[model samples]
Target chain A: MPTMTDEQVRAHLTHEEDLSLLHEVSMKTAGVSRLEMCIQCGSCGGSCPSGMDMDHTPRMVFAMLRAGMRDEVLQSNTPWVCVSCYHCVVRCPQNVHITDVMYTLKAMAIREKKYRDVAAPEFAETFVEMVEKYGRSYEFGLATRHYLKHAPLRMVGMAAMGLGMLRKGRMSMKPRTIKGMDQLTAILNKAKEMELT
Target chain B: MSAYTFYPGCAMESNAKAYYTSLMAVAKPLGINLEEIEDWNCCGATEYVGMNLIPAYSLIARNLALAAKMGNKTVLSPCSACYLNLAKADHYMTERPALGEKVNEALAAGGLHYQPGSLDIRHLLDVLINDIGLDNLKAKVVRPLKGLRVAPYMGCMVPRPDYNNRWSDAEHPVELVEVLQAIGAEVVDFPGAATCCGGHMTQIGPETAFELIRRLISSAERSQADIMVTVCPMCQVNVDAYQGETNRHFGTNYQMPIVFFTQLVGLALGFPPDKLGFGTEITSTEKALARIGVDIPKPTEDTPHKQAGLPMPSCLRKNAKGKVQHAEKEAA
Candidate 1:
């Protein structure tokens, strides 16, 4: 057997060993998440307006996190269903940062490609692309591209509303790129590089 | 006039044009000077954060850096999402040094750096209620919206996770109701006042959004509200632009007109309906305005022909299945 250095062995073990899912999420979140303080009181699930739509309530998801069901937790639609309303965050008995944790979960899911639905991820990707490109969101471009790619049939249904918006000059024909595009791009690129590391 | 660095979010330039128009008309009369930030960028809304952290924080921080550079102490955002994103970034960066350092590193590339907590981030509603004062607003009302009944929908972002402890209550804030009452309008007891408006779920999960939208409209209709007054552009757009689709999905006709609170403020301040961006909402506000003796010109263009689509069968069937499952479990 090839002799492995202590540093290499520790690194291998760290990669192989499963860190507590709760710890991973809490670390990823900004500020004091206090996710580990959750007592699974079901307030988060009960408070969520989109709770019914979620495959698992946030309370249940936290329980699953404790059980280290990484795939099931990450693949669940609960994170995507979260609208970041912060109702649960405010109502949590443990004062857990529920909404911030949800954001962290979403980022992790997107990074791991473990999300359940493409629609939410795709829409977010498109929105981010526009913000990155023009430094402004082009509603006209976002709706057109999203609808064409995901729901062409619904685009027909949406035409009237689209036309109304267009007539009212609500939807711009072209995006307004910021004058400091180079600066913004450079900042974004640096941020992107830092994010990967 | 007290000056503020205005961050007109991306929505303000587009679908929420009415909000922009009305706000501009009312700001001067209210003794407020809204200085548009020079070359302000998007706040990344709710999406960019879900994709990456540093970039999302940096995107918002860039705007903050610019506002700081412009020597503005207060940054005012009308859009709820923008307000939350900006406040959240400022709060988190200040609370967590590692994040602040990383964000500043990225910002340094563009010659931008935000000193966390250097600026006071506030929502438009907050300013109208706190700075402008209800008493001052009441005094300026040239035309009282006495007969019009409006549901004060504050949406989710402005109140919750309030970093500065500005709002009274997160769950059921009285600020919107107070503002509407100040303008001499009847404020309905709206239960869905702080409920989620489904956000981008309308695009990603139409069925889910339709149900959430249905609940809000049903409650407002139950209260016999003439219109829903909202402080957030996303709330107005979701409840107004998607009302028709929500109705179609649920097989219910709900012609609930949603308007920006700023538009109503402009009206009470005696600005003409056209100037306040009336008739811009997808749900026509003609009948609602008629209640208060305000006659606005009808939109000249003919309504586009709508393509008929079948009602969403799965959502309906899913409700039925849920009932059956609950019954079975109870029996077991």
Candidate 2:
């Protein structure tokens, strides 16, 4: 029940050679990720709805990071399969920021171009491209591009439903451009530049 | 009328148009004024944040800056992803000042600045339950949804993370139940209410999403829910649109209609069903509407039937008087 100061909580350095992966992941995560505090309880895995589909559970991923298994950790489909439901996040007794860690792992994998499963990352890239271009997501365009590239045959199956969505006035044919696209572009460009530093 | 700046996100204009229509219909009667942020962009959903931390935060922060500029103390989002992103950006910025400074530097490029906590970010459900109040809603129910049994599905994003300590419990929040009960709909004991709806995985990993969707629809079927009511557009889209595909994957013909909570609320408020965007869902609500009569028939049995188990955990049950029994008292 005792509360610690922010300085006290963040003062400890976790820089052992084997712990380098853990340290980088924690640092890259937006806030204090508490990745080092993991007890390897498997609460995250137990609570994850898609844990069955993950090659390694979140706890295993954390353990792998501590062991500096960079290639295995990034190559695993665990991060890509993560739906960001945050079930593992709240369930983690150590408060390891499971979902945020997944995001960081995903970004790292994308940067290194080391992922085994390409569809999820490609989807993310396609989505980002849409956002960067129009300041908003065009689901119609996104679906078309993604389905055609990744699941061409499935796209044929999806045609009926897509047409249904269109007929019911749910899907828009054209993308919406925000009035302040120039402003959004400036901020995004600056952020991208700063991300490099 | 309480006025709050609204961030409709991209889904409202397209896939979740019914949510938008139904929400607007109920807002006037509920004494809420939703002033949408001008020229607002997407919150980047879950895609941008995973790609680059800085740009994701910057993109989301842009919406916050714009909302703050509008002079509203509270900013509301209807989409769960947008709600989470907005709240997460503001929360992390406050929790880590360095990140805030970097994001603010990005904001400076757009001639905007966000002071992180200046505007309170809230989901539409939070406003409905907390600001609008269940009692007020109950009084306005011109046509109680008497026979309609709905599975109140909150999805995953809205309840978890507990950023502002807003939700009652991370795993099983009863706010949805309280609202649904107020409108006179029979809320089923839906265990999958707070579970994942597979999100954008339908596009990237169809098999994974199909299984997740199967679990939700099958759970609803087990409980005999007439329809599943969701707060998130993504949840509705995944469950309703891909339901046929999910059935084909599993070789099971389960026909569970997924609807926005606002659509049901609009019906209770006596708006014409068609006016509230009723017929737009992929799985039709025609059968569900036929069940609701003109009036709520009083329960013939005086006491509400208790779940046939070890006293149906207090969060999952309401007492005979239609009040939630506190867990401690129930245990005693």
Candidate 3:
């Protein structure tokens, strides 16, 4: 894959629509009024655990939202770094829905296919694969796929560690399939439709 | 006279058979009827929703739909992953009508329709603590796990705030702690009770999962817990079955028996070793049970107290002073 340019990524305008939907949903679901409560305080950025990894801190994302800088915010790598630990939400003085906003932003970013690097996309891909396969998050499979996709060479080290687990019956080579897997596939399709729309 | 629709999920029948066996063994004595829902399926465990939220919730909702159809007010699940999936679906459906509609639409194909809030989704610990009542449990403890220190691990799914099913603070859940105390077990206040055990991550990426599992085990070890008690099979398997690998990966020596809450209940209920599936455990609970003076004899068909309606065991009778008085008030 070629290095995605700013203009190439900026052409995708659907993320703003996603943000709007997220805003609407967040308000209805969580009673979180993120759009109104943000005061440009920079508190969310200060408390972010992965702040250094982002080009724009969480607070900046909020600031950009206020400024209507849709393309810049959508194209940035900030949202993917958020681990969703809720630390920022707990520390926010204004009680902004920083984490929810981050999730929404990440979801939008994912939908737009504007991820700057492979990490977030790989993580999301592995997460979806686990759900599709097992109808639930298989943490072992998820971690393995994620590492294998993002950092291929890491597999050798992982294999060495897994060998010990394999011997002790901790790790199973075959994924356990749930009964009525077809019904589960139908559920995933419906969920995908809702998420896509 | 209390009965609940049971959703055993996949793990309870297979890898977590001990949890299922112990649960069945202990329930009848407490007069709690766990009627397995007919033609039940998996609850999508923890990963399904992460990958695709709609189907994951829908798959879980299918079980909830069956439970609702049976007209059982409370649907009890012993597995944490199943409990979380069911609870998350129920909560999300009630909270988000649009999402609920989408999920219901998916379920419509299967001829299943779930009306959110029609059924109460509860974890086994929730039933034991809320419905069964601690007073009754305290009265029935023939074996108080006194000398054995236990770390209560709730894992990630059961205590989260998502589906409004959480009974305690998500960060610091106390249902397990309260139950352990009722069984006369020493409950250790340990961190990571609500942390993820990396669930299915052990299969996908052993190194990452090991690191996460190591953190939880080490925290429990630091708190001086003799064993870890969990409500989820994934947690039990990851923590118990994977301890040796986790130890090898991290170069740490930690041998802690990970047991189901139901197994602990079985021990407290005076069930013998084989009945509670004690021998199946990787780390021996024999030493821990021995500390509590519960030297269960070898499995035998004609044990002295095999009959169902004998007066509570002598140890329990001694502790029953408080329980009988409480039961009398309720009866009145």
Candidate number achieving the greatest TM-score relative to the actual structure: 1
The CAPRI category of model 2 is acceptable
Q: Mind giving the per-residue lDDT tens digits that candidate 2 earns over B222-332?
A: 999999999999999999999988888899998899889998999899998766878778786777777884222221221122322213455444442232123213322
Q: Which segments of model 2 are wrong by more than 4 Å?
A: A1-17, B293-332
Q: Which structure is stronger by DockQ: 1 or 3? A: 1
Interface RMSD of 1: 7.1
Candidate 3 on B202-245: residue-level lDDT in tens?
A: 65445656877888888998998888998888888888767777
Question: Given the true complex, what DockQ would model 1 score?
Answer: 0.32
Report, for every candidate in turn, its global Cα lDDT versus the true structure: 0.87, 0.86, 0.68
Every model's TM-score on chain B? 0.90, 0.88, 0.84
Clashes of each: 0, 0, 18
lDDT per residue for candidate 3 within A100-161, as digits (tens), equals: 46656655566566667656556666766765676544545655667776667756554533
lDDT of 1: 0.87
RMSD of 2: 14.1
Candidate 2 local lDDT, A59-177, one digit each (tens): 99998898778998999999888999999888888878889889898999999999997889999999999999999998877888888888999976676577567656677667789
Candidate 1 C-alpha error for residue A112, in Å: 1.5
Clashing pairs in 1: none
Question: Total clashes, candidate 1?
Answer: 0
